[model samples]
Target: MAIVLGLRVLGIDFDDEERIERIESAFPAVSFVRLNGWTIAELHLECFPEKAFHEATDLIHQLGAYGELEFVEVVPHLVNTSDIAKLTGVTRQAVNKWVTHPDLGFPAETDFVGGGHARQKIWSLYTVNEWLSEVMGIDLGLELPPMNLVKQVDGYLALEGDPLLDGAKDFHASGL
Candidate 1:
């Protein structure tokens, strides 16, 4: 069991190959790649039998603590605007307006899909929670479920591995 961490560092220049090389050297075991035009580096580290999931997760947290990472939140799952509205005890329309309002400090949706007539937006739950507590001065009082529940569901509902990891592996294997 392994956990994949996605880090967003704001200061780095993603287009500079030399800077990327330096980052790769700093983390030889982990895979790092630019995230489009976001100026963020996505790191993927998969451990074998040597490191347990919890240990790996801890190390990843430590890296964030020691590095220049601007945002380091564990992305558990994606939630829609309606879900956020329900959690915050507000209407979906209110949530939509909040997303567009820059003063609310709401995290931007991770994705936007559909054609001109139809559009959908989605956000990472972790980010939403962080913004709620840190920016909005609101806490939904979220707490982890019982260990029994976690063990039962275990891998059944975990987020899929980061695609950058898969693409990195392929690129390395092909000597690209």
Candidate 2:
């Protein structure tokens, strides 16, 4: 179990089904939400979350329940621009500019972790994979090019190593 913090902080359990069962049985009057969808973004729920929902990401650590359900508290996933640089093998400044996509005149799809002065975009590890598959045509193993890695030299998105993490980043930063 971990404590989720945001507008409100709450304790979440993800070790096993015991916590889920306990919450469900005890809070029969409360709303219950199911983990569903290719990305499992928690579209439906029995009740509104007091804070951000916690997501136990499947980052190749477990294969059996890679897409299975686990209880998570709601919270924004913290990420640094450098992490984006590693995923795309580019300089942090270039990655930050890429996130903005000002030259392309396109907006990223995302919800800022903190609104107003503290606002910053929330990037999902899962969305990065989908963009490569659907837009870049990468494979399930996260292998091969176009999706794996892209290098922008002379202002062109070039093909690089296997889209190790799918040569892509989901958000081009903006107020959103």
Candidate 3:
């Protein structure tokens, strides 16, 4: 099974599997608190129980009354339209419009001068990476450009599909 742990948030994301050898390799007596939605069924939790051997039938109801001790998974933030687009070799117009849309995701930020002209638009790097991995199937890494530097262009920067746009359009909409 695949387990994604959030060290900072004290949470874990787990996928069911036949057996978790990694946990046994590290923790001999590790306990899996089976949580299906809000209810916790203590009966379903066996000490290092074989993944396939564990009873998954009615897991939510079988958990019984251990709601207070369950380890819940926290949701991670997502990368901005432009950042995700740049990382995925796509355009901001596509990222902002065709991809994440208005009600989802966030914007990028940099520590350089003249940044954050607005405050509510900043994004955490991990959140952005998490979103990319979940939505655009792009892995977030630290290999992005340092910011404030984009592809150079010439003449009036129209909002249409100019094909000559530097790169900021990755943040803005296309055909604006």
* Top TM-score prediction, candidate number: 1
How would you encode candidate 1's per-residue C-alpha lDDT over 1-176 as one tens digit per residue? 34344444555566767766766677664445554345444434354423433443444445445554444333235678888988999899988887889778778789976768777888877688888889777798764322232232232112213444544533332323
> Each candidate's lDDT (Cα)?
0.55, 0.34, 0.35
Tens digits of per-residue lDDT, candidate 3, 44-113, equal: 2232323311222123212222221232222222345565667778877776564336565543443332
TM-scores, each model vs. reference: 0.40, 0.30, 0.25
Best by lDDT: 1
Which of the two, 1 or 3, has more TM-score?
1
Model 1 segments beyond 4 Å from truth?
Answer: 1-76, 144-176
- Candidate 3's C-alpha runs over 4 A off are 1-81, 98-121, 141-176
Poorly placed runs, candidate 2 (over 4 Å) = 1-70, 73-80, 103-109, 114-118, 132-176
- lDDT at 30, model 1: 45
List, residue by residue over 75-122, the lDDT tens digit for candidate 2.
Answer: 223344565566656688875675676663323545556678977665
CA RMSD, predictions in order: 16.0, 18.4, 20.6
